[model samples]
Target: MLKGHDFLITVKAPGKLYIAGEYAVVETGFPAILVALNQFVTVTVKESGDYGSIYSQQYRENSLLWKREGNHMVFDNRDNPFHYILSAIKLTETYAQEIGKKMKCYHLRIDSDLDSPDGKKYGLGSSAAVTVATVKALCHFYNLPMTKSRLFKLAAIAHLDIQGNGSLGDIAASVYGGWIAYNSFDRNWLKKARHRYSLTALIDRKWPQLNVELLTPPKELSLLIGWTGSPASTSHLVDAVGLKKAEQVKNYQKFLHDSRACLKRMIKGFQTKSLATIKEEIRRNRKLLQSLGVLSDVQIETPLLHALCETAEKFGGASKTSGAGGGDCGIVLINDSSNTQALLANWKEVGIEPLDLHVHRVND
Candidate 1:
């Protein structure tokens, strides 16, 4: 089964951009739509001597020597940048042991195209992508059968171990490429279930309310992305909103209801292949997020993001901040009849750099 002389195995997971339904998606059973971008985090595993090393191109201190102590990974240095990768390795290896697979030391290397040239994050869900890529690469190395569902569950478990908050929608998009309508599973349920069930039993069980459905965008619909050159911490923003959510319970409930209804209509737009309806709901979703920001006292839409949306509107494209959005990327939806060049020009004038990214399909 080992084809290469070096016994190398490589896997790449695509980064994701939220199309609609941001904050609300964090709640169990709430829905969000996202697309996997062409950019990716690639993980390569190769046979090593006795101990394994991890090298990442994105970090200044790139290499870390790790050895296995029973099931635990003992790192040479505690100052490490690979929390998500380490989590993935630990969880995947735990599952391997559950299924009677032999484990061996292997060198893992990571390369990412999800950030800017100078190592600035572009809000493309790099952590989720890297986690998925690491889990996928290790599964292959262990000769484990990895279905899409299994991959998503293992990756989600690994990511949630590090992140501790937010919907795992990014993991879904990374696992199942292209456009997807995702409903978050109940994290509370998983937290309790993990104590009751083993890793193998949990992977074999159905996660409550978690759903991932591939979506087909209308042929006439065109997507545009613009980077504001500022990266936001998703965990910090989510925590901020969570703190306010309890104080304004009525307002938070209203926001959730509105988001669910709006996303339903948008999903219908996709089902009917109506580009106009999809764009209309995108504008509506933007307004909802603005109200949410006002209620939560979080600046979800920065000035640069506001300018980005306004410029897109002037050019006949519906736009909004993509994710948690303290300052990151904004997404725009246009049609074949729209003026694409004018939009790019106006975006640049406002200091918004248009990114040349496309939807990445798994088969592609």
Candidate 2:
């Protein structure tokens, strides 16, 4: 039973990223920090007219066929949009039931600016972003509360609904917004715990949040981001690392322990503006990634990325790949702005595409 006329609603959701803390989070059960960028997905909800539907500009392009039964938005097709929207609606429904009210029904137009211009999955969490946006829109439409944790839970549902095994870090980053320290090994997430922490507390309380975040902003770096043009799987690399742990237990343990110490120091260095110490950490971290088998010899020395790193070195900066790097985007943290153009031109010489990322708060 429904009564009121249609109402339009819109909600914005940000993009996902990693600023500091990666695999460490999953292992040590610490928070992996990330910066949510301006890249976002917007969901437009329209009250059901004679007909109802949903469309995504950048993702879930198939305008889902729909039928509005009073206040219910019924699905006519199945896909990412179907499951994600339903998950949001379901949560809203639960809330409505608890409050003894009917949730609003509106046609949804969901879209994004994060899709690869070429329609490829760039290993970024585009779907996760969409899921978060959908959850936010539905929460707004139904006048349901939106807490970072509850929102993350919805996104996780959407993600798990689509791809069974989801990355909690990416979801947490998008839901919380801004820089986040995510370690999947964080006992909290593994234990299904959702305790939250702030970058202010994680970083030096003295570290300037605004300035530190600006480092990974949406600007295109003078560096190059290559796709490796191959869909390299992290599973195999991860397995190899795991297998080596028991076989060469002593060596691998030492490597991990050393790397963890280096990362801790690096986190401190980042706080103190100690670039000198930071450089040592990156060098040691890369070596440790090598030891853990996260980086392959072919990857680190690839002529394209290697050349790019070499070029950045000459310009007083460093470059490396992001994520579980069998093949993924490479990032260059260059200190020299004057040489960016030439550096980019040189990278273009090798067919690596430059990717721009907007960095900001991960949550409200």
Candidate 3:
């Protein structure tokens, strides 16, 4: 049933950056904005004779041999670095079975441009991009049709099974590609649904409170990103906030309300193409995140991050840390492109490295 050794399929999924809504977006129905970047994780699948191999350019040491064991994948190495890829394979193959598609052995290779050449993470959601790429590659290999929504659900399921937290906005950005406004679905409902429904059945049903809308940013809007040269673990920061939520129940509620309001105004800015409204909300959101850090006793913004924001403010741009930031990138929104060169100069003077990334839009 092999197509031939020459048969090959490749798929690439773009990395994502959070534009707004960090800590609060983890809760169900909370809104956030994100953009897909041109940087991507690419997966290539080649038809194999009998056994299969999985390799990663970034994790060369973790390459291993695998074979099919009666509808299940059996790996030769236990301590492999391809957890997200393996999960994607298993889930997609399971869905393939439900659709009566035959499974075949193949050699899978992964390559990523999501990190620096020296292997430093830029907080660009590499894991999510890789997972999405794996699922997409397998779907193409199996001749399965994948709509954006279906791809998102399959990838989200695989990702949630592994890391088990966060808003999955990165996954959405990878699948949908471009500027998106996302509201997270109820994870508790999803946890229960997994027990009652098959993978195929679950993906077909609508997820509660989940929403993803493509946004068209104003033509005059100029977005600038500056990296602080330090990687922060999103899971760690989110976990810290989770632990403090019970103690600060009322404060958490207020933060959620304020975040929702702020996001609504920003979304309106996007709709009306009002750069001023967007900038004001960005500044407001920054203050809210600072307050959140104090309330949760977590250091969301590092000293370098503060400098990143202050420098942007001084250059006439509204800015804040992009993601769950103890350290990582900061984003600035400005209408005047003239200030960009000066801002980048000042950012470099203050130890911030300006990253040349732009919003990526996918062709349908």
Candidate 4:
């Protein structure tokens, strides 16, 4: 199945978890803090004997052929589950042309463990991770000089082209590959940049407003991630909340102020390792999210998620639902590692699955 002198390239990207600043991050220029998890989505590309193809190990699919047609690449069928992959390929082809380069024909294989053994989605930002991996693989395969900013912008474009809405906090975590204090890029600035230069040129030029900084968690603090076994559609929840925010301008503005204050305290708390400060801020943040749910008539903080948070608080830890939070994962932060076992046992009793995740440090 292999040809002599065939080339192979592999690339991996970490999944992300939001620590704070959820709904507010999408407000043009707001920021969110997230940590890249240990779990990764990897993509591999190897020269094919015939036309180009793609295979997904996670999806357990056979190779699907693809070919270049004029200035674009077309797959065997357009109705596949992995539109993320297809979007990456097409976008990369366009990037290559914009930068005056040629793309080679190769077979791409994607693998991910963000899903459970029974195929339950963990709300780990799989689409962002997959897009990052695909872009990295294509850049590596073509020997493109890809930098972190370049990769992030390209992947963000590909993802935006499909989903049409997101704060891009997940993409920032994947590209930076660690705990980060991130502010969303200015939409107007990015629009101008897209019109002014190619992606390659944009990478070389500095916008100065794009804010991404790395942060190290203190040694005393530990995190526990628990899944609710139910998946939440982020788009649906965001839309519901967005519609309400438009109708309740005064309430939304007040919520934003409180959310920003909580996030500021949490960031400082991480630096100081002040358990009391962190716990209070997390509690306030949780309360705001609950209010958002009530205002939108959406279950942003479902009873199950609230129970998990309360249980963690009862055990002297602070917890809240991570991300959009109707039902995916809740993050628990504790000062002592000794509490981990007890927390896990209690979570098990309540049917919450504990995820084995940690901060992922990127290699320079």
Candidate of highest lDDT: 1
Backbone clashes counted, model 3: 0
Per-candidate clashes, comma-separated:
0, 30, 0, 0
User: Over the stretch 1-364, how does candidate 1's per-residue lDDT look in tens digits?
Assistant: 1133467998889999999999999999999999999999988999888999999868755556577999999764322338889999999999999999988999999899999998788999998999999999898889887889999999999999877898999999999999999999999999999999999889889999999999999999999999999988888789899999999999999999999999999999999999999999999999999999999999999999999999999888999999999999999999978889998998899899999999999762
In angstroms, how far off is 13's CA in candidate 4? 0.8
Provide the overall lDDT of each model, using Cα atoms, as 2-decimal numbers: 0.91, 0.55, 0.88, 0.80
TM-scores, all models, native as reference: 0.93, 0.70, 0.93, 0.89
Predicted candidate 3 versus true structure: per-residue lDDT over 61-144, tens digit per residue: 545557698999975432233888889999999999999998899999999998888877899998899899999888888877
Ranking by TM-score: 1, 3, 4, 2
Off by over 4 Å in 3: 1-6, 61-81
Which stretches in model 1 have alpha-carbon errors above 4 Å? 1-5, 62-81
Q: On residues 7-67, what C-alpha lDDT tens digit does candidate 4 reach at each position?
A: 7887788989888888988776566779899888888898765598888867665345576
- Residue 194 shift from truth in candidate 3, angstroms: 1.3
lDDT (Cα, tens digit) per residue for candidate 2, span 44-78: 77777466676765555545556689999975432
lDDT of 2 at 213: 22
Error of 2 at 27 (Å): 3.1
